[model samples]
Target: MDYFLQLVLNGLFVGAFYALVALGYTMVYGIIKLLNFAHGDIYMVGGFVGFTMLTAASGAMGAKGGLLLLIVVMVLAMLTTGTLGLIIERIAYRPLRGAPRLSILITAVGASFALEYGIALAYGPNPRAYPVGMGTGSFNVFGVRISTGQLVMVVIAVILMIALDTLVRRTRSGRAMRAISQDPRACLLMGVNVDSVIARTFFLGSALAGAAGVMAGAYYGKIDFLMGFIIGLKAFTAAVIGGIGNIRGAVLGAIVLGLLESFGTAWLGSQWRDVFAFGFLILFLTVRPTGLLGERVTERV
Candidate 1:
């Protein structure tokens, strides 16, 4: 029972990270219906950016001013990653919007490689140590040990999820996004700037992923160029498990994936962690392609 509780705690903590990365994929799919394969790489970039900002600040202010410096770094990371997302949409995706899905898919693959090598050149092909200095303490609840860092990460993920959910459910932009998702041509006819909305969607998704990258860097204490790949893959599985294009589904999927993976690791050993998670993903897709909460989508033809 104690071990079970510990696994549950660890799973929830990891799920928060998955949810953050999944948001970018779901949001982009929501508006554009294109799987931005480069999104995973965008997340990797966010970690590096946060790492640089955090390290530079740590040098200047020492651990005493960590909170203030962290806040500033967070803002910079969100802005930088958000802007990069918009640019990627415009420069990489926009031109191919009306083209075949195959063409856009290839473009996404190219963009992914470009971002990866670009970062490797700029940062060098070495793992960088993430700055430490976040909260440090642990409390036991019913024999489940929980650390302050995990607690903070879970809270931050929740805040981001709530803020995003509210914005999607309540705002005019949200309405526009939904309309475009349903019928982009109709939205354009209704005088909604479909292009701009898609751009904003990319920005929001990338910004959230960036924030998650920051949290992950803090928690894990190290980062690399390919850090987002495995997590991103899991998050996509989560999105698929819940319903790929649904925001609510992404969150639900993330929690389920996190808990399941955590339990799988505990029961089946760490070596088979990914294999188990991915096996479930394949099984789910084969059995129920629409996912747990996903609406059934049909081809136009």
Candidate 2:
């Protein structure tokens, strides 16, 4: 029972991170119908930015600047990455908007590879340890040990998801975004700036990925150029599982994937963990390809 509780708690944390990152992929897919493969690199960039800031802070203020400086770095990185997302849309994606989907997809793949290799060149081909000010202390919940960092991460993820859900459903900008997503031509006729709306969506998604980057840096304690690849794949899987293009679906998918991975790793041994998890995904897809809450989309004749 204790072990089960521990796994559940840990799964929640992993889910939070996955959900946050998956938001980027699913949102862009919803609005643009493009995968935005470079999203993982955006996440990678955020991690590196935060890492550099932490190294500088530690050098200047030692342990004294630990918590406060970390906060500043995260905020800066998020804002930077958000802006970067806008530029990426404008530069790499917008120009190809009217092009063939295959062309745009190849371009996206190229962009992703460029970002990855660029980071490798800049940061070198090595993993850097993330500095943390927090000590490992936990609250005992029915013989389950849960740490402050894990709890904080989960809370932050939930709050951000709620905030994003509200932004999309309740706000005027969000309405414009939805209109654009449904039919960009109609949205344009209705005086909605489709390009701006798309940029904003990317900004929001990238910002969330940035936050995930910081949280990962704090908890996982390592940063590498290729770090985002595997996790990005997992997050993409989560988005698909939840219902691509649906915010709540992404969150739901993430939790299920996290729980599945956690339990599989613990019970079946680490070697078969990913295989088992993806195998379950395949089975789920066979039954319900649209995912838990996904809408049935039809093609126009």
Maximum-TM-score candidate:
1
Off by over 4 Å in 1: none
Against the true structure, whose lDDT is highest? 1
Weakest ten-residue segment in model 2 by summed lDDT: 62-71
Q: Measured by TM-score, how close is model 1 to the native structure?
A: 0.96
Give the C-alpha lDDT of model 2: 0.85
Per-model TM against the reference: 0.96, 0.95
Q: What digit string (tens of lDDT, one per residue) describes model 2 on residues 1-301?
A: 8999899987888888899999998899889888788888788888988888877888877554555566688888899889988988899999998899999889888888888899899989999888654345679889988887787778778888999999999999889877877799999999988999999999999998987888788878888988778777787788889988877898899999999989999988989877976886787678777878799968877
Error of 2 at 191 (Å): 0.6
Q: How big is the positional error of residue 178 in model 1, measured in Å on the Cα after superposition?
A: 0.9
- lDDT computed for candidate 1: 0.85
State the C-alpha lDDT per candidate: 0.85, 0.85
